[model samples]
Target: MSESGASPAKIKKLDPTEEVHETREYDPETQKALEEIDSCQNEIDQLNEKASEEILKVEQKYNKLRKPNFENRSKIIQRIPNFWVTAFVNHPQISAILEEEEEECLHYLTKLDVEEFDDIKSGYRIKFHFDENPYFENEVLTKEFHLGSTGDPASQSTDIKWKEGHNLVERFRQRMQQGEKGGTGRKRPLELRSFFSWFSDHGDPSADEIAEVIKDDMWPNPLQYFLVPDIEVENGEGDDDEEELEDEEVDDNVVVVEEEIEEVDEEGVEEEEEEEAPGEEDGEADE
Candidate 1:
């Protein structure tokens, strides 16, 4: 008997159905909510996989442009020599050449100005031209050497061509930010062509497409912590499935100990009652 004097009965081992009921700790609402949340997450993951694949294609296309032996059908970028200063820059006769001819021979000069070029021996003069400025020319013509990004002595050259249309990172960031701030409320089509379009020109993305990407990247669990309004989470709400997965395993020792405890309690209560019953019989006999 328990301390409250109610007779103890064996606690029936829960059957599969009963076990399911007890184990089903989550209310229906919570379960439904969690299922929905999981579905949305799966959809997002799939979208991410698709987006990543497309990004890889874009990366490959650009990567090929950086290589010399890409397939014949691929876009070819003429492999100009890596050095910034060309043979024209090093040529002995270049000192006497006209400003226009010097650039034409070099083929990579972007800027030319007269003040930089001046009178020297052999009617040669130094000039200030940005396309290939002779920054570190020796005072003597024989010792004159041009310094540039890829030159032997100068260290300022980097391959990042900051041309007029090369602001891709900035433009993508702006588009991503706009998508986050404004709820487009549209389903984006999964189109590879759209990626090509974005690559070619930094333009405003279709609101629907941006929304789809955002949906894939957004997290429901994170939203809960952020306290974002109108966000819903479903399935095993608040119950970490990780723990439930672990608890499904039971230790034989624990079950044995609990059974032993119940048995001991039953024996102790029965012996006490038996002793009390004998005393009550003796009292009646004496009376």
Candidate 2:
């Protein structure tokens, strides 16, 4: 205070009686309502935490059980040659879909692979690899199907293409291409829907008519056994409550600022009244 030539601010201590009077200003009913809200929130938080812990325990148990079952299945399939193919052929629904000629071609099928795209629900690819056969020169055929935004199995667009790899007979055939038919005729790329329908029905097929047959009934569900199970996620209610709390805090800050501005204005008016009182006393003395 001596360095600045200004008086130090004094802090007033409240008496015990004054503290008691201050407590009387709060309504009991209002205080109880606030306490009840806090209690309910605490209970909800505890229950949510316990539920999350239980869910995690169940998931861990499921994974522990699932791993051994998957390992056993994999070992069995490895021991059995063409195990998946044999199973598909024996299935009543699948057997009903194949014709005599198609069944003959299917028997040459050595490998089947399915690949999901970046967005799992968006699309997938089905690839068929065959052994050396007399039907065509291509060794691998791939088909990609695009799904709708609504997660419908029926695709709006389909891409079908043949990968190049010559069979033993095809290699000899390529060497003999110097004759009158030097270039072997290129096999035309078939439309995905038409090919699957013709393969399934052994009849003339159209794009629209085959869409439901291949996408909805065939590809997705039949290959589900090979895909990993999707994990389920719970919605977080705490995040919503936190956002609401942040909004309330912002409103309280605005009210505090307004109250501070009003207090400053009232202090300025009191200073002006005190300055005028001395001027009025001097005017009365001059009279």
Candidate 3:
């Protein structure tokens, strides 16, 4: 105890890194328990690694099995006009990046192929096959993404052979050249660019949203999106839309009719007043 009659303050506990307590206050049993917990964690990690390996084997097996069916489906899809483009536009994720120009350009996209590399975890590639159109000269455009062991993603895409005055990516470059108010345009972020331009983009590889959408969603079940318009048509949606338009027109005309009725009522009242003036004058002359 200090001379001031107060108990001496106990030594402040420091963080493990700040000051190592060679003589740990924990009991031997507690220390041994912590060691056991670490050992348990190591075992769990080993089990998780084994489970991942098993999952990978299953994925590889199913991926190969699904290949032939996918090829057959592609052949059938070719029979349908504008199948790939329609499916893409219907996709919620892909459609977000697509604009009118991209949609029109994609009309020429006859086939789309998404292939995973042998090591599925490594990465995958998306190939777009287009017919000769007013767009770029490349009939086949392929983009590949490679994810390394360290969790870093790298991607490369085919250089677009744009015809004269047909570069979509220029839209972003142009915006950058023009220099937006906040210097954001000059930053040249890939997110602002439209569809085909995105293929050329190498930035933001981790956020390759459209590729993920194609692989995880559209590749497995594209027919669902392809049949969207057909479903709407089958449900008499066209007729319903027409009826709604007609109802809106009728509502508009009703408002116009009410205005005309008010005008006529005012005119009728003015005519009645004019007739009463002659009667009043005749009565006054008689008096």
Candidate 4:
């Protein structure tokens, strides 16, 4: 239509091909239902987002409160000499699990550190540092625990290694010589095995047994302290009640069985008495 375009070059149309498809038109009721569903979904999404934001805020507040408290605790522990030793010794549950020979060596313990590697894999490394001791040449010993995907301690793997100190190698050599003379040679110090075993044993324990373990300071996880509530107090009472109920049920069954046995005995005695009476009457009549 333009003066220089010659009728707009004849407008071209899109020819329908096999790939072309028609759009479906839903009925009024179905369209309304779909709209309602979409509205509900949007509402749910909004509520979830709001809830997550609130939860995050609460978690942030908790962390802010926890940080200072933890710092203060660390300061207090640092100020006290032999604090770790005293803490472990004072706890009856922890003391009971340790060997008598280990008590002296644990006194030399200067530091205990636990590190977690969650990025590469789920695992923990426990490091223990001790002062100069006559036992082994290693001042620092590390034990690692590699956990499964499910975080089960029963399926964990462990590795033990140590760094050599100045006097440890010489002391170990002397011990080996002594042991060789006595016809008793050891590959490693028994103390190392004992310490590792104690820690590893706590990884998985019976529910009742684990309660005591978690209360001790030796438990590496600080989160464990606040995360697990004191529900065991009520659970203990419930367990006692269940035990009492079971005992009562057993007693009731025993009483029922005894009553049935007494009834059978009484019936047999009555029949014997009836037969003896007839014999006596017949004998008297003959006389």
Model 4 misplacement above 4 A: 1-76, 119-121, 150-196, 199-287
lDDT winner between candidates 2 and 4: 4
Which model, 1 or 4, shows the larger lDDT?
4
The local lDDT score (0 to 100) that residue 110 gets in candidate 4 is 69
Question: TM-score for model 1?
Answer: 0.21
RMSD of each: 34.5, 32.5, 11.4, 15.5
* Candidate 3 per-residue lDDT over residues 1-287, each given as its tens digit: 12232211223357867964444355677666755665666678779989999999998999999999989998998899999889987776677667666688889988888999888889999989999998789999999999758767889999998888877677546754785422221233344666776788788677787778888899889999989888888888779778999999999999999999999999999999999999999999999
Candidate closest to the true structure, highest lDDT: 3
lDDT of residue 246 for candidate 4 = 97
Off by over 4 Å in 3: 1-25, 171-190, 232-287
lDDT of each residue in 1-287, candidate 1, tens digit only: 12332211222346657642333346677666756665666678779979977876775665456334323212121233312124233322221221322233234432211111122111211222233323222121111222322424211111222335433334334555675321222333333122212323323322233222222222111123223222323444555676666665456567888999999999999999999999999999999
For residues 1-287, write the lDDT of model 2, one tens digit per residue: 12322211221247866642322333677666655665666678779979977876775676566656645654554555554455454444454433333455555666545555545445655566667675554577665566637644443222223235522233333444643222223222233221334333323222333333444454334333222122111344347778899999999999999999999999999999999999999999999
> Local distance difference test, per candidate?
0.36, 0.50, 0.79, 0.53
User: Which 10 residues in a row give candidate 2 its minimum summed lDDT?
Assistant: 225-234
lDDT of 4 by residue, 63-145 (tens): 56665665566556556677666556555455444444455557777665644453223445556677777555567766555
Task: Give the TM-scores of the predictions, in the order they appear.
Answer: 0.21, 0.31, 0.67, 0.35
C-alpha lDDT of residue 78 in model 4: 59
